[model samples]
Target: MSLAPRTCPPVYTGSHLDTVPQGGKYDGALGITVPLAIANYWHQLGYRPVRPLCIIAFAEEEGTRFGKVCFGSQALTGKLKGLDPTALMTREGQNLPELLQASGLTGNPFTPHFPPGKCFLELHIEQGNALETAGFPLGIVSAIVGIRHFTLTFTGKANHAGTTSMDLRHDALAAASSFITHVYNSALASQRQYVATVGHIKVEPDANNVVPGKAEISLEIRSETDTLMDSVLAGFQEFLDHTAQKYGVAYEIAKLDQIPPLPMDASLKDLIAEEAQAQNIPYQVQPSWAGHDAMILGHELPTAMFFVPSKGGISHSPEEFTPSHDIGQAAQVLEKVLRRVSAE
Candidate 1:
């Protein structure tokens, strides 16, 4: 549907529609479904808010298809005004520019625009068992965690695996392995509740008879505080220095991205909390471990998130599940929040 105003809407309820490969049913879709349900409820009741209510089903949030997280939100925000669609391709080898052209977006450019004035609220699965484990149906998101990404590369001399002596030969993959171990242990010891992952890795000449000459791993760290993420990053750098020396290898660190933690609007968060209590739904205020479109839009609007418990702290997989009751409860809080914000 076309926007009624060129300017920002006073109220917005949206979530992404895309999912990762083999992704669960609830991850991005639940957020959109809940808001749409609320809009439909208001329509059935012939009720109207003080201002316009916009329901947006944003696309490509997972970025799994093209490796661009928050694609839809970024475009709506005008961040993609000059994006070169031809430079990106889907996993299935589909050309982005061609796809857009086919969808009738050839000459026209995309402008950033999910513009919200008074508030934006997103309801999503907790993606963790926090609420479920705590016996609460819903959660009030106080903040979204900050994220830092880096690429760590290790370089060493290639040698025949059979001819290389254990102490004399330098192995890039070995050094990479040590760094990964260090990351895991350090995260476990974090007092700031940090999570560090070396999820992607590759080694050159991946042969059983050849020593790896180079290894690269993608490193990501997340926490509620930027300072904490920095602290960990610094420590990792130091450890890498020692690792390079110890393994007789050289290392390089290339920084990729950093997303600062975003605190939800105080009043919006409080409103959700208050409404939860009023509705007799138990709630916990917590920080989101995973990223969300809410975090991106939070920078543009007074935003907040409501989370329903995932059955087993699972998400982004077919196993992800949230009870129907939990979803209904979270939706109720979002509806109440919208009503309160609209009146203000």
Candidate 2:
């Protein structure tokens, strides 16, 4: 019912976690605590459910240490195929196979197998401004957005800034800048659910007196529908090719990771909505822009997710917060839904 609990949970700090060095109070912790609270309430009331309930606190959803997100869920579902235990090194100079053996798990860590489930549900905080913007306290997730990470490199001649003629020079940084602009305009002009971000960029050369020779860009694109994602990516590819040719530079794009959009079960969504209505809670049906373990489980079993409002739509930081009343409301709604489902 509960996993590891923090000692001094993260609170409102003016600075980011990197500067302040604090943990978030609700990023991934709330999903576990809220369910435990619900179970405690039923125990206090001496009420027994018609069906059994199991709560799991997945080991590593954030991958903050290993640089591999969804480690627990991926291990459970056998998605860790081809993962070499010897190749994965930790901060403590530990490898995965050694770590597993130390913990008494004898087989390869990548070979873990989990049983099929009847139903799965995850309660989480809305990591975006959707619920707050919509003026709702709760939301039932309709789908989890598909994700794609792109690594792009633009190569051009590195020359002296003072001596190189503007007309004759091929500037890789300028070409990259053009593509960044296109990524913004195109995604903004597309469907409301489509989003694209150029998160990281690097320019080569000692820059004060040199024309940039190479540029590296890390681009991430997400969409609620796969078709829309494909369309936007195609547009981006065309623009990249055109920009490279026009600027007299060469470019390469490599897809680092791609996870397709996953839809929540229709029946489970309806059930949550009904429970929210019955409890007189304000709710909306929306899609999750961020990833979660529910997306991994939904691949095979019936899974549902309900979300509570996040303050200022901020998360993954020290400032992330959810009001106490909002948290209680979400938990009550969750309990109502689980009780209803147990009866069925």
Candidate 3:
């Protein structure tokens, strides 16, 4: 049978775990090693792909050093602009641009992105319990949740905690606490697959004697549906307004980042399902709560991700693990999908 060969160059065939200091071994390594295993199997069987496959190992996906996640992918796609290299200083007090120039790269690092034709697949350990709880060995990702992050500040008049009467105090910390409660309640009440969290909070004048006059919190909202996320944000804004008025505090919010939800390629997902069935591997289709480089590149190219079950659905920890059988099943399915794509 004549096959249409894929022509994409520099396929990202690498482990993508640069962030999450002391991350699980399989989080990034499996995605890299599985493809190599498949290639070795094909070679042993005297099978050759119609298209050239190149494996690349990238070390900068975590963006811990530059404060930019998916640094390599984003840079190559020209998604990063107006970057002041001199302003970006490392923890060692070194300018990032100067470091790049010293390394023999002296131009605008951002380049125009070209759609590298189809055939992008990422195999990862499911960071959630969906697969394991459902007793599925493998899973095809349906979509990646959209993410919105914000920094909120609540400001009020600081005063002596012991002298301030309960009714007379314009407590920013109290208002912030109410907001945090609302966030939890709303998330629980949301009918859709939505989650809102106030993970970080700081109280100003954090002293036993001083009433907090300023509070800052880090808020993050995630949902598979953009419309749902927008609705949640609207409701949250209203709550924030009400809280500020209740405690006589002034509130401000600064948006940090917003990434839209991404749906997987329908045809590719179907192919993955077929391959799983053909291999007698139990699989499911699920939404990914966490972000990945696959989703970043998936927006521009036809990309697919297969997941192996994580023990107790835990990931990004030193104890994170996936059983060998689950890994094998996922790898086999990925191998089949790659072969089929190559033959198409």
Candidate 4:
């Protein structure tokens, strides 16, 4: 999908219009623009193959409207649960099914087909400091990390800030703050490549004069291994149980979503690496911290991902960019992979 704003809440609000250029010929529109160009190029070259080639513009990959990542991809992959139109809510309180219907998307995104394929490849900008740090123009991803998102709520008694003595007050936010710090330290203690983020937090009666009775926070943990992720989560759960017992508060840990980590097809990855070497493109095999559609698609198909360097490793913003030459190189790599797949 285009990098447009989604119709969800503050977190999900993403619009393609944000990336439109003043002159209307901007460079950073590679996600959609380049694929379109490649399809046109293949057509112009009269490259008719044994299998059908489809250039799709998937909707809501950014999860900007639903606070859920990989919505479109999940729907296609038969991973989405429940279809109640009224139950879905966006940031602005708009129903997701309504939005889909209004947008003329057939109102049933789950009906799409994702049959087995020879391979699936996605070309995206490497939204990190890796390529530039390694002085490479391209990267062949080895795996995409699995992500687990959670919504944590800590509940306690709300009391008058001035009337309650510091020693007697049951402050949920205070306990939550400590728990957040503990999470940080636990992840750091592992000394491995893992990320834990508490990106959103909301407290009831958020007033200066009142002790918070309830607080809800969003937490995300990503790691290359399910074992490490489970270990980190176990640490968090242990901390929560201990903190609640120590502080006389109640806590709830609700899993919002969990996606398994996906290692790209080793043979296909090696094939791409070989091709990159043949083309003399500076490339490296790296694991992706950020999740991508390729991770899910890779489960059923021989999938590989090609990454072009992002300028300063920025993405998901108007300034998110990679050079046009890098884009062209990635397309060339993708074309080569497609040709190889077609041959098989």
Candidate 5:
């Protein structure tokens, strides 16, 4: 376990709004800390595990700085494509490779070192209402929703807002607004665990006096099944095309990221569930809406995840919280899973 220099931007490097908080020091930081504590406890007990245990601290899981998510784990799982350190630039035009060199990681940005493991498990706080709503202290994740991101650009004629008259103007923003509503409605109609978000929107020459000529929006869709996602995406495309035609605008969809949903190892999930039951810690099975390192590692080996309730379903914020008791319970469940897997 050697510390590697981070190739991605630091989590809270002067971003506009802080998604992570400084309150309890146990949000993302504890994911690494608890594992180390467990390992130290095992070592102190003079118990040599049958299998090797490696505690990993993944970089850029929050994706706050870089516009990409899961940068560290994706690199390890060989899922990242067209990643060039030199070509990478921040909002301030800072070079990524230079940043990595400044931090002192001794390897190519494209290549990551991963330890061979018989199984992988991550203990994290559930960033949603599943556990809290179910009156449970812990959750055994069944699967992680796959995510697909698309950048949609609509091109129309920029014209005078006042003189353009009623029907003569082709407004990109109006067309985009229609598409956005449709995206939401379509997801609801699917009646499944589907989520669609329009997180970013920008209009070229953002002036109130002029009709928007070009509008760009970032959209994301997540689902547990690839087939369901495909159907949703296809419908989204149709909506885009229809809206463009109706508004007499040119539109294109560019894919930013696509991560297929990951299913956790059933046996491991069951083991954690059994452990929770035996310990009298209320637990339930649920799906992860947010992607994580476990999703990436699940591609290679047996992987599972446990979640503790996040206060108010808040995460990625300084206010994100889980009680110490809940954290201890989740860690205890993880210890059982580790012990069981290591013995085999």
Candidate 6:
């Protein structure tokens, strides 16, 4: 939150409360702590910003058991208007209106609205090894990647595992496995612009003594552009069709979800780069592989994001970490950017 008096709406700097299941400690947490630390430093010096500056934290950002994604950002921006509050329930069944009332969702430190040209800057762990591998302490994000989800089902004749000969069997799981391999290998060959994952699978009779008769797969694909994702989907479908035919299985696909990519504010990126150079902090430009609230706010406001390195490029796990040196460097650059942007 801004240390200055709220004579008017403030410029914002903060991060969402990342509730991604198995999320790393720094994912949504450090972004807030570092800003709060800066706010405290300003208070200790009895200094007020030239413009109102706020440090706000958003929760339920990951849609992980906590609830739907980016709840706080969407709500504050009035994206929830006209929707039934009761219909938007938390994982625990807490309604939107009630949750806002219960949490006192708006006011001093929690305000989301600000001057249109003003900015929202966030600092986060890169969650990938882009910076870590390059030995950079910080990064300026270019864009947040888009995501697509698909469910593919395969059907084949079931037969006794002991009785069915290998030459006469139509194995659905085999076809699905080959399709998954194709998906992964193709994504890997897409020059890092595309990534695909098949994390969920279900097989009928799930038994040791049975030849699988049906299989279902949940496939996720991500990229910076819709066109690339669409092309990738087409290629994957072709491969799946051929693999299913070879295995004598029939297959179908369903689209589950999609979110388009959002680019960060260019002017803000320039400021961040200027600050990093001024502070002598090594930095580079990268894109966020994971979704974030900044993407939500970017739709309505000028938002920018910077990143520190995630140890081993690991995220969404207990091993997620960043060194204090890298973290401090990030905070330093952020504080400088905050001072410059708010003063302007």
How high is each candidate's TM-score? 0.90, 0.87, 0.89, 0.78, 0.82, 0.87
Off by over 4 Å in 3: 1-19, 81-89, 94-115
Worst 10 residues of 4 by lDDT: 8-17
Instruction: Please give the TM-score that candidate 5 achieves against the real structure.
Output: 0.82
Each model's C-alpha lDDT?
0.84, 0.79, 0.80, 0.72, 0.76, 0.83
Query: Cα-based RMSD of the predictions, in order?
Result: 2.7, 6.7, 3.0, 7.6, 6.3, 3.5
TM-score of 3: 0.89
> How do the residues 148-250 of candidate 2 rate in per-residue lDDT, one tens digit apiece?
9999999998999999999878899989999999999888887566999999999998487899999999999999988988888888889988999888899
Candidate 6 lDDT over residue span 65-95, tens digit each: 4456787777677665555555776668886
RMSD of 5: 6.3
The residue pairs in collision within model 2 are none
Clash pairs detected, candidate 5? 19-316, 19-317, 20-318, 21-317, 21-318
- Which candidate ranks first by lDDT, i.e. highest? 1
Write candidate 1's Cα lDDT for 1-344 as tens digits.
Answer: 12234353578887989888899999878888887888888878777776677777888898887898988888787778887767788877887778887798765345655554767888888888778878888788889999989998899988999888999889999999999999999999885488899999999988889999999999999998888887888898899999999999999999999889999999888888899999899888889999988987898888988788898898888898888877887888888887767654
Order of all candidates by TM-score, from best down to worst? 1, 3, 2, 6, 5, 4
Worst 10 residues of 6 by lDDT: 106-115
- What tens digits encode model 4's per-residue C-alpha lDDT throughout 1-344? 21222221110001122122231222223545665676578778877544545454555655666766666667777777456546768888898778877888665666656655556667767778789888888888878988899999999989999999988878899989989998788778776478898989999889999999998999999898899898888878888999887766899989988888888888888878877878888898888887666766777667777678878776665677677788777777777766665543
Provide backbone clash counts, one per model.
Answer: 5, 0, 0, 10, 5, 2
Question: Which stretches of candidate 1 lie above 4 Å from their native place?
Answer: 1-9, 92-94, 104-109
Query: Which candidate wins on TM-score?
Result: 1
TM-score head-to-head 1 vs 4, winner = 1
Over 4 Å off, model 4: 1-32, 35-50, 65-68, 75-109, 188-192
Candidate 1 residue 125 Cα shift, in angstroms, is 0.4
